[model samples]
Target: MAILTRAGRIELANAIKQKSIYLAWGQGAIEWDTQLPSEPSSSTELTSILGYRKATRVLYCDADEQGEIQVPNGRYKIVAGPTPHLYCQFNYDFNDGLSKSIRELGLMVGTKPKASTPSGQLYFQPEDIEQKGTLLLLEHRPAIYRDQGVRESFEFVISF
Candidate 1:
């Protein structure tokens, strides 16, 4: 069997750093008023999306002997190591997703349309853009009830 070399893995990780990535949140189905939503074993996309936001930070990081990712510089940069560990950070302002219950999160890859200029067509809320991308990563957890004055921040490490 042919095994992929460490250099080959670093190449793949470097390639991923060039893509446009976004973080999306959704309100998945609930069994009842008392039951928390459960993550489906497999899903092509989020069941019900609240909104999508461009990643605040993306980096190629290294992992320790025990597979724990080392701390990366805060700036957006790529530093490929022996292992392919992609770190991603997403931040949502308090005004975003207000009064909604978020039960699922996904990492997506897609293009930014020509019409999507920051000044002309911003994507700060759910209605700003349609779910038009490949879902790369998915996570389901207990519902988080959003409030008007609370901001949401998430950090994820994707090992390729």
Candidate 2:
């Protein structure tokens, strides 16, 4: 749950200077996965399918609620896309005795979301984020998006 600790501020500062960061979305219960990086390290990685989905996107680190380089905490919003991305769709129904259901949403961060082998990935860094992925900031949260076709907007807030 801790993105940047007191000791990781230096790395966080360097990461903040990057033009963009990778955002990986997934489905699961509303809880922190053990795979999430408690702190940036060489071995942090994501494994479970419930906590990981292939549909990933590159996002700008533009915090709307605060400045771009807000230290203690920085917020980044993923503007709603035109169409729903994978693992981001939602459907609900109350017909059969309250059958309303939704896919849990989780967020993770990395240097890049390359779809290639570990070694072939761009901006690959083990400590920052290896091919396996890193920084699971958000655990699954049930979002009620009745229109599955419409893209959903998401926000990521990280504090150092």
Candidate 3:
């Protein structure tokens, strides 16, 4: 997968400065969705980095839990599977040491997984415009182990 280039990082910084929410899907070749409700136009730098053209398809969905946000003028469903961790990426400028603060806060609230259980890590690259910033949002889920005598279930974030 191609990581966000320097120019792409710059564009992301600008988007954040403008308070625009940039949406991308996929572990590789992210498809940029619609501009945030507050932003007016898409980021050219971001599009270039993604190798997007006029013909490329962008899928948009609501940021809310109800999936009220829409692009292409329709409603859609989001699905997810059970995992030990939930990962997220953000296109924002993390300057003024704000990113560090956020990371610290997350670490404090986040639970540590058992050494015997499998663990997951979410990676994020913050825009360059931000000073010493990389946004890595991680949601850790506790591991469950059971034998034939017991049944176990897991919780996941899904949109439907």
> What number of clashing residue pairs does each candidate have, in the order they appear?
0, 0, 2
**Candidate 2 local lDDT, 64-128, one digit each (tens):** 56543333344344443211111221121222112222233334444344444465332222233
Q: Measured by TM-score, how close is model 1 to the native structure?
A: 0.76
- Arranged by TM-score with the best first, the candidates are 1, 2, 3
Which one wins on TM-score? 1
Candidate 3: pairs in clash: 62-69, 95-131
Q: Give candidate 2's whole-model lDDT.
A: 0.35
lDDT of 3: 0.24
Clashing pairs in 2: none
Write the number of the candidate with greater TM-score, choosing between 1 and 3. Answer: 1
TM for every model, in the order presented, reads 0.76, 0.36, 0.16
Which stretches of model 2 miss by more than 4 angstroms?
1-11, 16-20, 29-103, 111-130, 143-146
Off by over 4 Å in 1: 32-42, 64-83, 111-117, 120-127
Best by the lDDT measure: 1
Clash pairs detected, candidate 1: none
lDDT of 3 by residue, 1-77 (tens): 87866456545433433331222111111122222222123322221111100101112122343553332334333
Off by over 4 Å in 3: 1-72, 78-119, 126-160
